[model samples]
Target: MKARDRDDEGRARSARPRDGLGRPLPYGAPGVGRQPEGVVRRPAETVAEAQRLLDDGMPFHAHEVFEDAWKSGPAVEAPLWRGLAQLAVGLTHAARGNTVGGARLLRRGAVGLAGVDPAHGIDVAALVRWARELADRVEAGAVVDAAREAPVLGGGGRGRRLE
Candidate 1:
């Protein structure tokens, strides 16, 4: 078997490049740059960066941002971060045509975020609503345009919404 690529810490990791939707591509093929993992950032920074990634139609990358928060941020906030990560992955799946996976992840994410107090302008209620609605629509045979329909994460006076 071919040896797996190892990260600097020597853990095996995929060296394959990935597409915009985070699909693995052939080695040596040009692909989208990946979001660095395990970055420790302030809550506001996390939300800002995540919003930019989502606006850029890179939900998979956004998920990485949320994952970092979930892993490194305050324990009390883990669920919100984790839910956001799942929601991003759901969008990724939907964009990639995995309806079942998309719907499942989306619902799971919404459940994770349900009733969480809004923190750092995350607009938890709006996000949960968007995730649930999108999942329902996608399951009912609606096509997903992840980028165009990406939710505007609250911050900078931008209201929470999906358009």
Candidate 2:
């Protein structure tokens, strides 16, 4: 049939159960073929999207993206992304006088970002150093000096351009 029809049929079939080899997963199956080990597959993507939203001053939307990714389970960077998402929401909260929530999320995000190196993606030591330093500053509770901090955080502000 048509592509849309096929997709619809697939979704419908996926709702039912069958034999193991080629069976459709029951609702909420932990890992369909491409799903992550314990988490759903989109944490990384979700994080990127959330970052985009956050840059656009859409903290609420970013929070939802991170929340959905966080629920996916055991993503390699889910903790980091979720923590960052929480941080964004916390910033929003703090702006609205929710210091408790903002501090909590920022603390969590810093912890989550520990030991991660953006240079791993491109093998650039400078980038890694920058990322590590940014994470360190965040954890140390210093006001993030974005201007001086940009190069150290890799790509001279690549994160901002992503959105």
Candidate 3:
């Protein structure tokens, strides 16, 4: 096997190109640009950026944004961000046609989100419900459309209103 790439700190990293869904492509294949990890953002910024990516049907990129929030935000908010990240990944998997994997992650994310307080401006209840329902649909052989069903992540539950 070829040697895996490593970062400056010797942590495993890939400089590989990735499709919109974050799937690795051949070395020279064109792919989406990735957001740099560890850039801290305020809660609103994180939500807004993630919402935009989801609207663009780029759940994997949105997942990375939430991941940054989970890692760089306060410990208390880690679960919330992490749950959101997982939710995005679930969407990514579903869109890519990984039914079982998608449903599993969606359920996991919903479980994590269920325990969080809703004072963070995210409609946690709606998200949990959406995740559960989507998981069910996905399991029943529904085709996932990430953009068309992207959840409204902000606006006091009014933002990113789904059409």
Ten-residue segment with the worst summed lDDT in candidate 3? 154-163
Tens digit of per-residue lDDT, candidate 2, span 35-147: 22223445445545544454444454555665666666556756555654555555444433444554565555555555654422322334333344444445455554222
lDDT of each: 0.89, 0.44, 0.89
Q: lDDT of model 3 at residue 96?
A: 95
Q: Which should have the higher lDDT, number 2 or number 3?
A: 3
Candidate 3, superposed: residue stretches over 4 Å from native? 156-163
Q: How would you encode candidate 3's per-residue C-alpha lDDT over 116-154 as one tens digit per residue?
A: 987457878889999998999999999988887679886
In what order do the candidates fall by TM-score, top score first? 1, 3, 2
What's the CA RMSD for each of the models? 2.0, 13.9, 2.4
Evaluated against the true structure, the overall lDDT of model 1 is 0.89
lDDT of 1 by residue, 89-149 (tens): 9999998989999999999999999988989977888888899999998899888877876
> Which runs in model 1 stand beyond 4 Å of their true positions?
156-163
Quote the positional error of residue 16 for candidate 1 in Å: 1.1
